[model samples]
Target: MSGWTWADVDVAVPRPGSGLPGVAMAGFRQRVRGDVEIAMVAHPSVTLFLDLSETGGIVREAGGTSRRGSFVAGLLPGRLRTGGQEGSGLQIRLSPAVASVVLGAAAELTGTVATLEEVWGRDAGRLEERLRDAPTWDERFTIATDVLARRLAVPSRVEPEVAQAWRRTQAARGRLRIDGLAEEVGWSRQRLWSRFRAQLGLTPKRAAQLVRFDHAAHLLAAGHPPAAVAGRSGYADQSHLHRQARAITGLTPAALATAPWLAIDTVAWLAAPRT
Candidate 1:
């Protein structure tokens, strides 16, 4: 039997090649022989969890709702967890900027977990079948990339100014001033606020908070002291960090440090090169 540990899982990423910005893909196969469960922390991305397992597929739970098989998780789906008997899947992370175009429903998807079928209709089932049938991880990655590239080619409904503002907010690690972002994007503050919320599904301020919280969460998981994390992540102080951590994740800084969801990030995300 395969060991019931993250270290026993096989992780794969796409081969180096030109690909869309604001998108990353990783493939994961659990080596464990039986049941598995994992708590998922919030991240500042719209994530697609595509199940390609031959046996039981994955199930996700959030906001007291559970969805089985492939699903799309919107930004900041709070306190989520996933489990299954044993399974393998591909995870695709899309920045909100790109998700607005690729998903064509980023604003509607915010803060919710929807079955892949809900998002892509019959195409969801077809895509999962193709991925499952692929003989190798590399082939699956290529197929996923091609699909995403095609979707991204659709004309974006997001304003260039809004996309630019989101990029700047992320580049600053959420430390940027919203007014400055509006100025840089050549939009009035009101226009930026309204358009950003309409197109990206969250106000600029909330987006910044999510980005900042994500950074702080990773630092805590990496074994940094909460006080140090607060300072580095731009919170006013340790207490400020504590409040934000609780608000965003409903977990204390200490608990977040040991979160199982983040534990695999080094293997599944950090080490993998983005396609």
Candidate 2:
């Protein structure tokens, strides 16, 4: 039960100058002397891990399958199992608003983890090589930002109205009502639901719940009591929060308060969106 030392998580935070909306970059180099397991809690953004280690080997279990190499993980409903002792890479988070355009893929990848090779083909390998060759973390960040910008040049943009809906839902911290979201977007409830699911890979209700769960989880991790976390996060009551706790991370609020993964996030993704 050794704790992670600073050396275990050499981190490079995201560059504030990079103005790429919906994209954040962090550089991580890790070395493990023993086995470690991490719970990949549900999150609102799509995640991409670009392998930069000497060996392109790491195991990710999500949606009943294990994937290796640099990979793209869509928004998930619950934790995934990450079993690996060593690896170093750039982890990127993309809001669903623009993930499809940036990856040239679909948000339909929800609950699934697929290799970067599958998503970006040989280009993915080439990008990894470029990032690995960069002399410093700053250099890597610049390269990643440039690559994403290039990919976005010829983008597959989503509808502006749907994008607005997603942004509003996020701003509300998942406390949004679908009917109200539809009203704000000036679309019928049924239309909003179908279009949101079609473009974002998640139904509006599920997205709201996921966002709510994320806020509550972080509150618990920050040492807030479950009752307070529940009230502030829009849960009906403490009991409601307990149900979502099990649903999102398979742990009670008490257990999640000390989750190692969330602890790592403090330094590893310092600027990542929590709400």
Candidate 3:
């Protein structure tokens, strides 16, 4: 079981259809006969996991810190990992734009993985208990989305200008110039950088690059060549794409294209079919 990966598990992605805005939740539950360690590759969104395991809870290791309970992972997690025996949980992804409220502040979670208790306080346990007691996966999804919707209803969204800039960055797949975005948003470069980082837990440049890599990674997974992906993903060339792939995932572009972390996303998100 040391070779465990998302490909080996049965993932259930019951959709909420239209209720959840800017939030995605996927439920994963499976048992490995023996010990297993899984490498969780980085992604572009803030992630939260709700644990309901009857046995061992999931453990996560990132950077120099590690935790073994229900948790939230910030953007650009560098080589996070966890596994063993068997486990069950709900994984939720939140766009940084709406995360500021649903999560209290994305900046607080940036680049780090923390126990849900740390981020959600007393409410974390309550949520977990409620989810655990639920009779069905659909119920958990409903409970989880309802919780986030309640938080979002309280107001305190990101600035409209900053949100627009982020949307543009995603639309361009990180190819747009920082200064250009600042000009269009009417904020100085310095101001944009500060506010963006403070609210999203990532600088504009980093966010753009993350979005770019996400697009390219999926392209590669869909069987596109690196050279072609580089051309369309806004990189200078193939070599540039290779370096970014290594920097972000510690894997060459080819290997990252088939990486299991990304493969499962295809199944769970299912917005795009495999080519």
Task: Identify the leading candidate in terms of lDDT.
Answer: 1
List clashing residue pairs in candidate 3.
none
lDDT of 1 at 173: 82
Q: Write the per-residue lDDT of candidate 1 for residues 49-89, one digit (tens) a residue.
A: 99998754798888787767888889887778888766789
Better of 1 and 3 by lDDT: 1
Worst 10 contiguous positions by lDDT, candidate 1: 266-275
lDDT of each: 0.85, 0.79, 0.80
How many collisions between residues are there in candidate 1?
0
Candidate 2 wrong stretches, greater than 4 Å: 5-7, 63-67, 273-275
In the range 1-275, model 2's lDDT, one tens digit per residue, is: 26755456678876676647788777776666654556777778899888787676456777677666788888883558765557677888888876888776556678777888888889998999998898898888888888888877884667887888888877888998899999999999999999888888889999899888888888888999999999999999999999988977788899888877677677766555421
Tell me the deviation in Å of residue 242 in model 1: 1.2
- Order of candidate numbers by TM-score, starting with the best: 1, 2, 3
Better of 2 and 3 by TM-score: 2
| Candidate 1 wrongly placed segments (more than 4 Å) | 1-4, 271-275
lDDT of 3 at 62: 74
TM-score: the better of candidates 1 and 2: 1
| Cα misplacement distance, residue 48 of candidate 3 (Å) | 0.4
- RMSD (Cα, Å) for all candidates, in order, is 2.3, 2.2, 3.0
Clashing residue pairs found in predicted model 1: none
